[model samples]
Target chain A: MPCPYLEYRDTSADQSFDEARAFCTVVEEFVQPMRADICNDRYALDHESHCEIYRAHAEGEE
Target chain B: MSYEAFLDGDPVIVTAALTGGVHGKEANPNVPETPEEIGRAAGEVEAAGASVVHLHARRPNGERSFDTERFQEIDDAVRRHTDDVVIQHSTGGTGAPDADRHRPLRTDPPPEMASLDMGPLNRYDHLTSENTRGLVDSLHAEMVDRGIKPELEVFNDGHRNEVHGLLARRDLADPVYATLIFGPGTLTRPRPEHFLTAIADLPDGATFNTLGFGRHQLPFATMGILFGGHVRVGLEDNVYYERGELAESNAQLVERVVRVAEELGRPVATTDEAREILGL
Candidate 1:
């Protein structure tokens, strides 16, 4: 998702419009699918964290 | 144990927001402010078939608060008065900024659930409210640590996409509980197509609720029941009971929701059933 915070903050004139355009162009060129594939890894981490919390609560109840 | 079973039972989970943070005593003489008054109002709504009470604590002088002591008093008072109704606190207390909106959860830990506003919203059409990425991550961490469920509040399609992002990133859990807020001059206008479009974006195993601001509350709530989503109603989001008359109490709003649900042949879900449905 586009970061509204960044959008609100980057309106400064110090960074020229040409510079910002060039930065975006460079980022798009360098982007790779490997970073996008990390979504599954993040999902696994979240699942483990949830299970740990549930296990702790179960133990406390016991 | 599944939400599908609860839906099959035809019971809607009615959440009564007893003390809304926006309105004050001047708008309606019955807007509960003190902890004792809020607890008392919640008790009545529970008796009137509301399974959950969404609370917003106020200072003694009627200002909103995320103070631990104030929230504790309300939580304790509500527990004293009712056993069946689930107590859910709002993280978006008055005067709270994006950085500190989840202070209630941090200080008081968590109740049964806490509100998780999904994304940046142009609330009231006057403010460009931003819930920063860092704030969302921290709030999700707190909820995870405390084992408290989050009631995701989505105000627009962009908000829905934020929820999807959280789910995709695994920041949100299964059977996410969402509430679609509809109002005029907002992202989604108060209408059936808006509701359908919002529902269409929901992921699998997700359950949703609906609330409409102002005069649209009744019609939107009726549509919510027919479409198998829960309903929220109270004077905080609205003042008048009808075209001109003011609402007498929060219980009156709760009663209206119940009547609409019953008229649609949907029974009200109990607190336990609601927990299962929302995966709390």
Candidate 2:
């Protein structure tokens, strides 16, 4: 199934995950190096885990 | 374990609400009070297809207590039976001091997860459910800092929004989970439209389970399966299996949920599966 959040943001109605992953790529713009730097210690990519930070903000707008 | 996986028709995670903040033998003689009894009940439910155990500690006299020592003992006993069953200690028991409320979060050896209410509410006689934003914020930070997953208890739409706020502030871990509770005087009624609407707009990666106070327990479990969500069931939610019928043990309630889910073709999540599913 399509990623629900991606469908929500793009209004694609596909309910797919690829759309969500693709959306995450756009999000990596700001969160990429910053989140990687943040997640380095004691947390295997903590900031980027699930890309939740970007998703929460993006989905909240919808 | 992620919502993408779960929403892809994954097995349903069954959480056994072994002992809640309220109720005792008077409600059901089989309700486990002491650590030994709780340990036995935990084993039975795990064997009966339960992957997680949500627990509350009681004083030697059977009254609820948030003492770290009591929770530690109960956690130890439950672990002795099987490490597979995820132990989710609760921090939201009623009538406890602020110190006691924070005990589980600050305890030496924390649990896999802990019950954290979104905010406060008004309930039965002389009871006021209060979870201030300040405390809620602090608790969220502690859970993230200690590696303890927060099993957010959602009492209404406000609670739902509160979770989003926490996420925006990055106070919670990824794949966050919520337990939407429906009971007498709850903000939302126990109806399909109400439940569906409440979680329909959930943010991506946010998953929630469902439960009811008494008569609504079985219905809540049934609805959860039908809606592609997880389920919570046990004596803590209801002592009776049906009208005028008292359940013999928590295993009885859990067995009923398993049988129903099977008849509907939804496989049960194993102990390890639950840990992974919940991001433990």
Please estimate how well model 1 matches the true structure, expressed as its whole-model Cα lDDT.
0.69
Error of 1 at B185 (Å): 3.5
On residues A1-62, what C-alpha lDDT tens digit does candidate 2 reach at each position? Answer: 22232211221233222111123233332111112222232122232233455456656878
Docking class of 1: incorrect
In order, the interface RMSDs are 20.9, 23.0
Candidate 1, which segments miss by more than 4 Å at Cα?
A1-62, B1-9, B93-95, B106-109, B123-126
* Native-referenced TM-scores of chain A, all candidate models: 0.21, 0.23
My TM-score estimates for the predictions, one after another, are: 0.76, 0.77
List DockQ, one per candidate, in order: 0.01, 0.01
Displacement of the residue B13 alpha carbon in candidate 2, Å? 0.7
Candidate 2 per-residue lDDT, tens place, B139-245, comes to 77777788899998888778888877767776466677988888777455777677877767566777778787788998878888777788999998898988999
* lDDT per model vs. reference: 0.69, 0.72
User: After superposition on all CA atoms, how large is the RMSD of candidate 1?
Assistant: 16.8
Residue A35's C-alpha lDDT in candidate 2? 26
